[model samples]
Target: MSKSTLKKGILQLLIANVLNMIFSIGTNFLLPKYLSVESYSQIKTYQLYITYVAVLHFGYNDGMYLKFGGRSINEVYNEEIQKNISTLKLFQFIMTICSVCVAFGLHDTALLMAAIAILPQNMIAYFKNFYQAIGEFKKYSRIMNMTTGLTFAINLFLIAVIRTDRYQVYLVGYIILSVILWFVLEYSLQRIKEFKPFAFDFSLRELYENVASGILLLLGNFSSQLLTGMNRWFVKGLMDTLAFAQYSFAVSMENFLNVAVTPISVTMYNYFCNHDENKDIIRIRELVIAFATVIVATAFPVKFILEIFLQKYLDSVTVIFLLFAAQIFYIIIKSIYVNLYKARKMQKKYFTKLCIIVIVGFAFNVICYAIYHVKESFALGSLLSAIVWFFLCLIDFKELRYSPRHYVYIFIETIVFLACGILLESIMGGILYITITIILSMLLLPDAMKKIWNTGKVMIIRMRKSKSR
Candidate 1:
């Protein structure tokens, strides 16, 4: 793809991600304050369970994206797409039913209801990914932003007008909106004829093949989730619901900061998958380094902003910082893996290393919590897991003739930037000082500034061209 096209793609991705961040931030800020700490924790837990459901449906969803998405709709026809969709829908339905039954059997009525309510949401997400893979950014962006806005508006109305103490009301509203959006999306796709439903001989052969690989992928993903989320679970166990509520807020802030990197990662994978030229590799590497630099530069100011806005919840700032660091590490590792997976269909080498890191992370978290406590153990586990994943990613990249020096440089820059921010925060005792330090640090990063300029110029050109067209 041309640079202009890539720039446009990134811009759309950025808009979608920004809308997502806004929706998430609005929810996090409003919901917890409206609901009691116990209710907030329950809401968060159910959300996590929903995430686990998504993971369980990973095979079909990923299969759809990889097989049907990478090609034109005509190239991969309605019969194939519909078959995969039906199979996936069936699989997801079965999983959902089984999960609901199990929850009921365990007498966990709250979780069962939450799972049932979130099923439509998950279905909408699958369709969203399909649209995304097909490059229908306009439709996808509209659905995402609108659904998010609707969710936020409903939550606010419930809290403000109805005075509903139950978070389930908000969840029900979310599910209803999701179902409406899904139907709209499906209708829109049908207008194109290519997306029309058609009967095909449904077979599990292809699905089984994909699932075999997906099983390993699923395990890897589950392990990563455990490593990332175990802390929150542990916090809930060790601390009170209020403490978990506080940590969740901080996590939401960190997630908002990292949202900017989402487009870079998505575009990186698509760019690498479609192009194999030597020149393209150079460009990819530059993009990766530039993206990483910008992310590192932006983290400090974003954190500063969060601390200011969430002054009432500043106690979790340190924990949030650690989580932010871990998230950045995750972005780097995932970016490289996206490229690796695209180039080579499937590899067990990185999978093995990921398994090892997960094992080490689990042990580290368990032992540290047993020895020290919740807060310190969580931080220490995140730091250690980052170190382990970093090295493992380095080893994997070397096998692909990729050097780790760029990542090393980015890591060092991040460390220095963070260290300077911490030092300034200690002495200055004001958010303004921290903000200035962050801005200065950003200015000091020449490569990051250049990338920003380049991206801006390309975007401006694209806008002018679109207007002329």
Candidate 2:
């Protein structure tokens, strides 16, 4: 795809994510008001399981992503593309079977909803990743935006029309919405030239081969999730439901902010898959600047918005700020090294780095919790983990032409900047920290600022066009 097309796709996806967050904010506010703390905790916990299960399945989608996205294609008509789709269908069947077992065996309505939701969720991810693999991002963006819009509409109906606060009801609604979304994805795939109906032929050999190939990437993905979700699991295990309710609420708010990062990271992966040094430098610069600028720009607003809507959980705002500080490193890692590792098929390196991050994160978490004994420990542990991973991934910097001087600058900048916001621990403090970050970043990295300005300008134009439509 042309760079222009890539930028457009990223903008569209970013808009979709923002809209999804809007709907989520609705649920975030309404749910806490109506559902008891225990109920909210249960909802968050079960949904967390759904996320974990989806990652655990080790589906062939990641394998397909590598094969199609990383490999140079003479044309999209390669026979292996068909095989990849067939294997994915078989993988979906297995996930479906797991869902059936969970629904029947658990006898818990919330868990059943989460269990069944996995199939459609996987299907949605598979479809999106397929579009991503082919760099047909415009179509991908449209499909995802439709899915999110539809889900949002459903959520509004459930909240305003049905007026139900029951967790089971929401889960069932999610299941139905997920199924409908799968159909939408299927229809969109059918329009693509490379698309084919899944053959009734199920290959045990291919399924094993594809899944086995993706095992490390899957582990890396799972470990990444574990590092983020580890704190929640700890909170759940160590504290009561009410305590977890507070902690999970902050996590959810941080996740809401994370919507801003997804499209950029996905686009970065697609861009990195191109084996061109010039393009790689351009892509990396763009990715880094965009994330650094946007993260700082959104920091204070995130806290303000959450406090206005989720007053009951206002105490979690400080936790959100620390998590946002952690997000700076997290975004940098994913946008650069993680995508680099995947495009290069460096899954071993990727998995190793992830394991180290999680292990160190756990150690930090233990010490922080034992010493401080507060909700902030979880965010602190996560921050410490990302810091270590950033340094560990430095070995690969030679490939990117990054020097020791660059490393030192980034290290000191991050520490000082995050320390300012995290230590100040207020909305004004967050705003001031962001201001300092922006000024220092521009002075230290003028080229990166230029990249950010270029990206920001394009986003402004496209955003206007979107509204005009």
Among these predicted structures, which one has the highest lDDT?
Answer: 2
Q: Any runs in candidate 1 off by more than 4 Å, and if so which?
A: 1-3, 194-202, 277-279, 296-312, 399-408, 420-451, 457-469
Q: All candidates' TM-scores? A: 0.84, 0.87
Q: For residues 1-469, what per-residue lDDT tens digits would candidate 2 score against the true structure?
A: 5567567767777877777777666666666666789777878877787777657358466776776784334455635655656666666667777776867886766666677677778877777787777776666776666765666676678778997777677777777887887877676555654556555556667677767788888889889999989998888888778778888877876776556777777787777776547555645654474465456445566556655755677767667666766777788887777888888789998898889888998999899999988888887888788778877887766655554545555666566555655565447766676676677667666677787788679879988999999
Q: On a 0 to 100 scale, what is the lDDT of residue 39 in model 2?
A: 74
Model 1, 155: alpha-carbon shift in Å? 1.3
Which whole-number lDDT from 0 to 100 does residue 52 have in model 2? 72
Which 10 consecutive residues of model 1 have the lowest summed lDDT? 425-434
Q: Candidate 1, residues 68-175: lDDT per residue as tens digits?
A: 444544565666666665666566667778777788888764577656754566567667767656655556667767776787888888989999888677666766
- TM-score (C-alpha) between model 2 and the true structure: 0.87
lDDT of each: 0.64, 0.71
